[model samples]
Target: MKYPALLPFSELVNQLDQFDSIIDVRSPAEFALDHIPGAINCPVLNDLERIRVGTMYKQVNAFEAKKVGAALVAKNIALHIEEQFLQYPREWKPLIYCWRGGNRSGSMALILAKIGWPVVQLDGGYKAYRQHINTELSQLIGQFQYRVVCGTTGSGKSRLLQALHTQGAQVLDLEKLAEHRGSVLGDLPSTAQPSQKAFESAIWLTLRKFDSSKVVYIESESKKVGNLRVPDHLISCMRNSACISLQLPINLRVALLMQDYAYFISQPNELMKRLHYLTPLHGKEKIRHWQNLSEQDLLHDLVQELIEVHYDPSYLRSIERNFPQLGGMPTIHLNGIAELDFLQLAERLLAE
Candidate 1:
């Protein structure tokens, strides 16, 4: 059968609600790295099969590789039909794509059309959708006004961002999206961060939904959040945007760090390993001192020392240099890290 009708990525994004599902027919690894935001993986060739087919094409010939790949694609498509598409009505519609406007998506799209469902292949496939996101993001990010949340470590900035989001204030929580806290000890316990492409996709998905006229609150972060980078345009906008500097008592900040990082206290060995990353900056002697404190269960004193000697100095330098607008930025001081303190702070921020 001839290949199915092709829909441009731009048009597909607008009419996304009409489709029952957006199916990605690429290998699992490709989909894992990135794909359309709402698209589900329905690989015509799984990862192992793809590697086998590529090796065959390289060592043997195209015809022999196609022969093996065709059988695998047919079985996978039949399984998808039986397991996934069985409940869909005859008139159901789905948009399909692969890495490029190619045979993989074409094969499944043709079969779905024959089964009496409307299926359209993405014209340039995932590549086109990715390009669209990159292009659209530059414009979308520029349209919004931003209020950057800035503070030293353990000043309750992230918690305040969460409260603001819960209170219906517009917020872009970069750390939540990156799954990292933007610091040396930022990595979550066992969770792995997303691929750079997937991270960009998450940012693009969020940017499209925000109302441009309203102020979007975000935390001040370095160019890179863990391994993934904040989009260049977003970083630039945030650095130039207005700032809200949060302040808390040093003792309270130390207590907040203990609560936030309670896991480190329970796992002394892990805490020791994470502290080693600071050796280059603070010297072996200082790092050893911190390690000894962790081993002796002296987290309160250790946290206070780190805050005063490490985090605060770095934060001050970064904010002053990167965010020029913050030179005379308004400050919000908090007496405690309790829920009530943040709630009142959120209300005040909203009023300003």
Candidate 2:
């Protein structure tokens, strides 16, 4: 409401939508690791400039570093205002933040306020928001009723989650958030996974939007999804939650696997390289046999063998050890891999 205001993280979280823009002034590297969900990066000191200033501060003196940093910050701010903020009207309101509530964001907020636009500076900045996420995640995880979807390899657990989401069910697709499929060959060929902090931020944002009274459908995942580790409390809650066991016939499972991993068929060399990771557990001889199968274009046979030998055994052991309630859980059997089948199963689960 004022020309320029300072808000702590507690108040800032609630009033986020009040501002037209949320600006992050941290270095690019810091912002990439994690930032407020919808905030835009407008780094006052970029990666190289930030490193240079730090070196000056350590090797030279505070006065020297401040002088150099001030000039760089001022120049960057001028360019940003000219390039980005030139068109804003008098009524435009923005929230600004940096790594800490220090010089960078303060400089931008001061300039914007001087231009007669209402501005808010985050009190403790990104560090404070990170702390809020950590604290809130532990508490928020227990509030919802989680329905964990359990199945063997290639049983279409992720597909079921997608279907439930289409039916307006609250679904937390952790694999999607992590940009992985949760297996040895889970790496997506098109995109890389998010950093651990970014993954946690995604989880926190998704959890915040859910209604505690409704059931949240989620997949049964191990501690790690590809390279990112699911938060400890959240994983523990999922393990303890009610279970939904999805079962597909072996032929359908193999068919689904082949469809999902069709890229491996054309890129047999890449598939062989990945299969080599299993050498330690399955032995070099067994892994070489699988690799040979891939080289020969016997994908269906390779997929079936991998499921029976590698994924199924590991999945069963992990599920039995982690989810003790699986023995008497409700099982949903799928006779086909059609979209209609998933939709029907989703409707049945939701109706219950």
Best by lDDT: 2
Q: Measured by TM-score, how close is model 1 to the native structure?
A: 0.96
Question: TM-scores of the models, in the given order?
Answer: 0.96, 0.97
Give Cα distance to truth, residue 52, candidate 1, Å.
0.9
TM-score, candidate number 2: 0.97
Model 1, 1-352: lDDT tens digits are: 2436787888778787788899999999999888888889999999999999999999999999999999999999999999999999977888999988578999999999888787889998888998998789889899999999998999999999988988899889999999998888888888889888888888888877888889999999999999888999999999889998999999999999989888887778888898999999999999999998888888899999999999999988888889978769888889989988898899878987
**Residue-wise lDDT of candidate 2 within 198-257, one digit each (tens)?**
999999989888999999999999999999999999888998899989899889999998
Give lDDT for model 1: 0.90
Model 2: lDDT equals: 0.91
Q: Clashes per prediction?
A: 0, 0
lDDT, candidate 2, at 268:
78
Model 1 weakest 10-residue run by lDDT: 1-10
Superposed model 1: Cα runs more than 4 Å off: 1-3
